[model samples]
Target: MKNLNEPTQENVEFMIEEIKVKLRMATAAAMQASSFTVERYEDIKDLYEVVASKEKFSISEVEALVSELGQLRK
Candidate 1:
């Protein structure tokens, strides 16, 4: 979305924090194993794109989706 251009500073920061949250959940589920997989990377990229476009999210819904995506990664 947003023509695939770079996000604003606020959006970039938000995406970074959101990605960290998702990564942490994924890593915890992986249980000391590697969580850097194609699916995980795609999840990060897709969510970043969404956030960059919408610039808004419902915390509960986003966290739930993030958790599901974590499971999907591996």
Candidate 2:
């Protein structure tokens, strides 16, 4: 596993990719890791943790998460 404690571009990319996979996002192709930055690392990590803890999610939950991610984007 990658060491995600550090706020690095690579770590951000890893977390974003993992979140996308875990969420089974239909628009995963549109949400590239390059769209994110270390400036929002903590927010992204928080979202990643929320996503990682759940095996499934309701449509509303997914929408909310996606919206949060959109807000965090550069």
Candidate 3:
């Protein structure tokens, strides 16, 4: 999310789109679910919670999450 910082209408939309993409990819997989899938699911769940919660994300927290996402690709 370039801007899923709080609950701004735009940011919520962005977060929803991001989650949808993840969900679609997961569902589209022909292979059986594995630990990797589980991990990604958990990550999505955590992201949903963060975006859904009323609390605003701190700069450091967002940075950490961004870093985590980058690491996930590797």
Steric overlap count per candidate: 0, 0, 0
Which pairs of residues have clashing backbones in candidate 2? none
Off by over 4 Å in 2: none
Please provide TM-scores, in order, for all candidate models, with all chains considered together: 0.37, 0.96, 0.37
Estimate candidate 2's alpha-carbon lDDT, on a 0 to 1 scale.
Answer: 0.94
Candidate 2 per-residue lDDT, tens place, 1-74, comes to 78899999999999999989988999999999999999999999999999999999999999999999889999
Candidate 2 vs candidate 3: which has greater lDDT?
2
Candidate 1 vs candidate 3: the lDDT winner is 1
Ranking of candidates on TM-score, top first: 2, 3, 1
Which stretches of model 1 miss by more than 4 angstroms?
Answer: 1-18, 21-34, 39-44
Q: Give the TM-score (vs. native) of candidate 1.
A: 0.37
Clashes of 2: 0
Error (Å) of candidate 3 at residue 27 is: 26
| Pairs that clash in candidate 3 | none
Model with the higher TM-score, candidate 2 or 3: 2
